[model samples]
Target chain A: GAGVSQSPRYKVAKRGQDVALRCDPISGHVSLFWYQQALGQGPEFLTYFQNEAQLDKSGLPSDRFFAERPEGSVSTLKIQRTQQEDSAVYLCASSPDRVVPISGNTIYFGEGSWLTVV
Target chain B: SQQGEEDPQALSIQEGENATMNCSYKTSINNLQWYRQNSGRGLVHLILIRSNEREKHSGRLRVTLDTSKKSSSLLITASRAADTASYFCATYFSGSARQLTFGSGTQLTVLP
Candidate 1:
């Protein structure tokens, strides 16, 4: 793909319903990340993956929030029992594989999946 | 609180004026990045400055980093009304390699 791609640009789910957002990272990129951005706020980290292995998920707000990058190319963020507070844009970003942060690979982001729990 | 915090929650400027936004981080960072977002749109990467680099310029955008002060600034020269958007600073924590912590961001409005 030309850039990070996300599905269901907008979603409306009833409270307590489950919703799934998909992301396809840029081709050949080795690092992928997911974030949640509430209105009027910056995007917050949700999880990170180095290849297919999930290295960090401490930022996931609760047990209901889960993300996985199955092939290290495509990822999915699933929210179970969505709440009103969960209404926000779920962002998917990817970066080239770099062993260290100082190496500084640019992180590209998707247009994001806007989820609104009514 | 997030690792990074941006100053001036909101900024209003006329077109052709220069706009500068600041970011402060609490901990050492490997690199700092700036992004722009328009209403209801995804973020667009502006620039990234490494800890070792004091400054970097790309087109009309200039970025400065001060590791000692744990701060960075983004200066947009000759701003345009199309430049109206929210600006954010994200940091790669020295201890964390993959996670990018973002600040609250500054909403910049450039009036024509």
Candidate 2:
């Protein structure tokens, strides 16, 4: 089965520009998550979606960050007025279900979209 | 805030030797998961240990969880040069969504 996949493997954007990153979760996956990882740092949660509903956006660093999953399978993370600090690798992960324990639900990750804000 | 914290930011070991990494979390969790990432790419899930389980094993990977101490340890026995990578411990909090809070990770270098 195909694992999670992200588009635009690399993106270079000038400061104050807007960029949108896309994610395609595995077929039938019910849970999707977005994370931001700085160089040599662990991934930080950005947002979560179950089906087509966005459940948690608390991890989003600022209001400029927004995400949506309208069709329940594909998601997009949009950054408005990107800043130099936004330079990092954006990771996407998906799991079968959220109710199941972590041991039972193995979250698959994508190669990630690397964003460079110059 | 990040829930998990891994000690010993970096480690260097000879091939065929064992490597141990530890993680500590501030809050209670239902399970602890270990993941490996190579070259800062996607993370690969290694093992998961439930709060009730003291130890679990998968191939060369061994994970142990101690709820009383809010800490966990991942041990790799007979590590090979290919095992060199960044290892992370993620905590799944109880009652919350299954989202994982990952630690900074420990970079391991296995020299052949």
DockQ scores of all models, one per candidate: 0.71, 0.66
- The TM-score between candidate 1 and the true structure equals 0.95
Candidate 2 at B58: error in angstroms?
Answer: 0.5
**Candidate 1's C-alpha lDDT?**
0.91
Each prediction's TM-score versus the true structure = 0.95, 0.96
Q: Each candidate: what lDDT?
A: 0.91, 0.91
What DockQ does candidate 2 have relative to the true complex?
A: 0.66
TM-score of chain A of 2: 0.95
lDDT tens per residue, model 2, B1-112: 6788998899999999999999999888888899999995799999888888999999998898899999999999999999999999987787567567899999999999
Instruction: Identify the leading candidate in terms of TM-score.
Output: 2
Q: lDDT per residue, candidate 2, A12-75, as tens digits?
A: 9999999999999999999999999999999998998999999888899999999999999999
Model 1, span B28-70: residue lDDT tens: 8888999999898888888988889999999999999998999
Chain A TM-scores, per candidate, are: 0.96, 0.95
